[model samples]
Target: MAHIASLSQLQTPPWASVDGQLVPYDGVRIHISAEALTRALSVFEGVKGYWDPASETFSLRTPREHYERLLRSAKLFHIPVDFDYPEFLRRLEQLAAELLVRERDLWFRPTLYVTEGHWGEGTRATLVITAFTQQKESGEPMRLGVSTWRRGTDVDLPTRVKSSANYVVARLARIEARRLGYDDAILLNREGRVAEATGACVVALLDDEVVVPPSSEGALDSLTVRILERICHRDGLRLVRRPIDRTELLAAQEVAIAGTISELTLVSEIDGFTFPVDGVLARLRASYLQVMRGTEHLEGVEMVATDAGRALVTS
Candidate 1:
């Protein structure tokens, strides 16, 4: 399966929600002098709405969890969340309904950012919700390489907060890896311990147990990683959190990357070492997709509305 090489390949929807109001995607704009654009003073959440063909419904998996993380990020950055969780959820559902996304999975990006005024000190925060349909992943395993750049430590920056500014470091590493002929880059913390891939949490299979780097080790407290932990526990699989050394990752039986957008991507190679795609990882991915599609019962996932629920006009 060919990967989505760039954002240019994605077709943006005609409509988007700005501050809970539906507006034309082309018309939605932020000030050029906004702090979010100038200084990257923003935090956002990437959520997926899985379309269920059997039920003809679209279910947003663990939206509350994502919203909670977004709120935590806002608090960390001192960005004001003027609207509550319920209102945000309602607006997301409304945006999906307005888009009339009938049998395709959709992606939702809800961002909170600071605006112009006072040169980035105590400025008011703004919100925007953008929803669009995207092609599913090709299921091709990614080729990763160890990055020369180090992940930001807690002392340097809040590793747990999903700040837009934090991604610049990962972006540089990814660009370097692409230049060296790799799909993605794996970052190690200052202590030289395995941190994570760009915007994704990593788990390795070792000695028949699934092990992941702890949040203290510069790994983002990823919601998808937590979901995988729960699924592993329920299935009688051993899942543990421990500091993984760079050498340990190279010798692992298999490695998998989990995140909202990546969605349990299998790693075929890291640096020069390669590992086969394991069955446990495949099972976990299948289970996750089932839960996301509402075919399997899972907590924290809900179907807000369906295509048949109401009539909508996209234009």
Candidate 2:
């Protein structure tokens, strides 16, 4: 692995939170109440920022929705925090202007935490924000292998909230799969239905429609998934929400995964079974790229690449 220069190595930018509050990039830390730490009472969100060199402007897509989800997660987890959405967005933009110099991609993570105090209880909630430069855009398709490990049952842990505790199951599954020469893992729900990949939502193209595991599949309700769904409906593609079995994946004409970080990625192969790159997945990939870049607008029925053999929209 190669090392990119850390933010500490760069000149600090003029950044602030929504409330015109400045956070120390040098020594910022979150203090969690003892009870919150012991019980894992915290919520977080992940967002991506793009730096456009041509315009010298840093832009984030749907930042407010990300914050809203964060707040929703906090409420879900019973973690109380002093939250202000509008101010938060302003602070992120200010931070991007101050800290980020190059037009590279970046990932922003903001966490609301409860710090422990005396008597095994929490004192106050704190916020920790960190930004890192991303060297690669997540446009390339990934190879996937279905994991033997089942995703954690929602009964065991809340799967709806973006909490630190939920990632333990994901970490173990993804790490073990990577050890087996897989790019990623697809976790199965309790009933052997498709769940999702590590840190991403999964959708498969089947029967000439876009099929995603229903919310009951124990998958996170992803904002990206919602956006893609809108695109699908507009394209007149049949969008089905149901339990997708392993065989469905094998039978899938094309496979794509969605997320805030990963965006729309074509799954070139699954479980060592290579699907043709020039297929329906390829078309979805092309259309998805156009929509995200704000290049093409979908007006009812539109043409999309189904495989790699078809032409792609390139930079």
Candidate 3:
């Protein structure tokens, strides 16, 4: 894809493939049964890799775990991917390095889909890996709003899997919210509880406690959420997962959302209520910076830091 000046610069990664074979980023052919393709029978995971100025190397936040989650999504959606874990990781690493440019951030995506087979009403199974980059957002606080749309429940669709079909609703919600003059939308669960932002997990501070909707509320299991939980624990903040009412947004002292694309960002306002940009959200953002930059690691997470004259090596 050509880099449009107004948008982020994105390039095809050399390591990306389709159906266990290397292909151009966009060349990956997705073979889905007509029924499944029309009904959105696909599972995908969006991940981000960071390029450290100090290390001058690109590092995936949690490549293996991310793929594991993707695998789980595939299983949940009845999709199949015929590739070993080690080879998958190796390919991803190769792609990340080859795809990196002068951009400050790189966005990576790996998708598992169903090939042409119709078992009942769904799809057969296949897998593809696609990756690209997005320009880093200048540090700016977002003004959010409560979305009128509710997240699709497991009863409605397989909420546990990160399926492409699941995002259609979210995409529309976000588009409508932006038309309403908000940066994003916070989806409520079927029970009208605050669940998550369309593409990100929502986190807010209530009574000095970190509150996020439990997975039971229909939020996607976000890798970014795990990172935030770790940061909260390290900072001595009490992390609580429970249902949050819409009114709680008013009570939230600090509000933020996390995702691979956005990472950690502060919400400056919701529904006209102004919020302080400097608060727990800011602190967490700073801590995340430290962790990703190789200054610190959250015990088990890996940081890709490179030494002088060292480049990421793959077999």
For all predicted structures, in order, the TM-scores are 0.92, 0.81, 0.88
The candidate maximizing lDDT is 1
lDDT, candidates in the order shown? 0.81, 0.67, 0.72
lDDT at position 88, candidate 2 = 74
For every model shown, the clashing-pair count is 0, 19, 0
Question: If the candidates were sorted by their lDDT against the true structure, best first, what order would they fall in?
Answer: 1, 3, 2
- The positional error of residue 57 in candidate 2, measured at the CA in angstroms, is 2.7
Q: Compose the digit string of candidate 3's lDDT tens values, residues 1-315.
A: 111111223344555655556676556554443544666777777766776656555666777778898889877766666777777776666665555665356666676656566663444565666667665554577877788888877878766788888888788778878899888888888888887888788888889898888788888888887888888888898888888888887678889888777678788888888778787779888888778656786887755432211344232
Cα error of candidate 3 at position 208, Å: 0.3
Q: Each candidate's root-mean-square deviation in Å? A: 2.4, 7.6, 3.8
> What ordering of candidates by TM-score runs from best to worst?
1, 3, 2
* lDDT digits (tens) for residues 1-315 of candidate 2: 012113424534334232245666654544443444776766778777655444444566567788888888877666665758767776666555555545465667777766644442455656666666665454666788888878767677767888877877787787877798777789898788898887788888888778887667878888777777777777677777888998888788888787766777777888877766667657766776566544566543222211111111121
Task: Specify the highest-TM-score model's number.
Answer: 1
Write the number of the candidate with greater TM-score, choosing between 1 and 3.
1
